[model samples]
Target: MAFFRQLVGKILKNFNDRLSVSAAAALAFAVFCVLKAKGKPKFPFVNLSNFMLVLQKKLVEEVIFDGSHILFRCVNQAQWHVTQAEPMIRGKELFKSLVQYRCQFK
Candidate 1:
């Protein structure tokens, strides 16, 4: 009887330890998600209509003039600077600009 009681106590203690570790991990993940979400900007300017307008403006500019290396350098610097913004829209904007500007020269 004593041997069975000891085995049950050991099992219960291990299960409690696992549950505590799991709870701690879950809490950490939730905190990380909240912080990451908080860093995102709720910008209304990321709609499809505005995106099309930006594309049209770029196309017009490209048609009117040849590409400049200075423009490329400035854009690269801008990308490096703005990469710190954790917002998805900012990331998309940076990617779009890099592709449009670099592709024109290449």
Candidate 2:
């Protein structure tokens, strides 16, 4: 997404006559970016910034992420109870361990 935005920005910057790059910064962690078109009568200030990457999930009986931790992974009706989770950059998860799982669902 960021790459596509940047690519478009570059094309618009070099070839666009009346296209002024407009951008919005999300409240979540994000990177705001803009085009840098030099040699203009007035130099254009184009910087890109994107704040955060979020992956929200809804489980069988509840909406997750309301709390600060992920207790389990709900794939369909199956819940892989997460006993341990490894930390990653910016609180993103890439690894987890579920040693023991118990579920009784009707």
Compose the digit string of candidate 2's lDDT tens values, residues 18-95: 433232223111332233333223322211111011112223232223223333333454433322222322233322
Q: How many steric overlaps are in each model, in order? A: 0, 15
By TM-score, the best candidate is: 1
User: Per-residue lDDT for 7-105 in model 1, tens only?
Assistant: 446555655586666665565567568767879543222343333344444532321112211111121132211122233334455655855764466
**Poorly placed runs, candidate 2 (over 4 Å):** 1-63, 66-68, 78-80, 83-86, 89-106
Give residue 10's lDDT in candidate 2 (0 to 100): 62
What is the Cα-based lDDT of residue 36 in candidate 1?
79
Question: Which ten-residue region of model 2 has the weakest summed lDDT?
Answer: 46-55
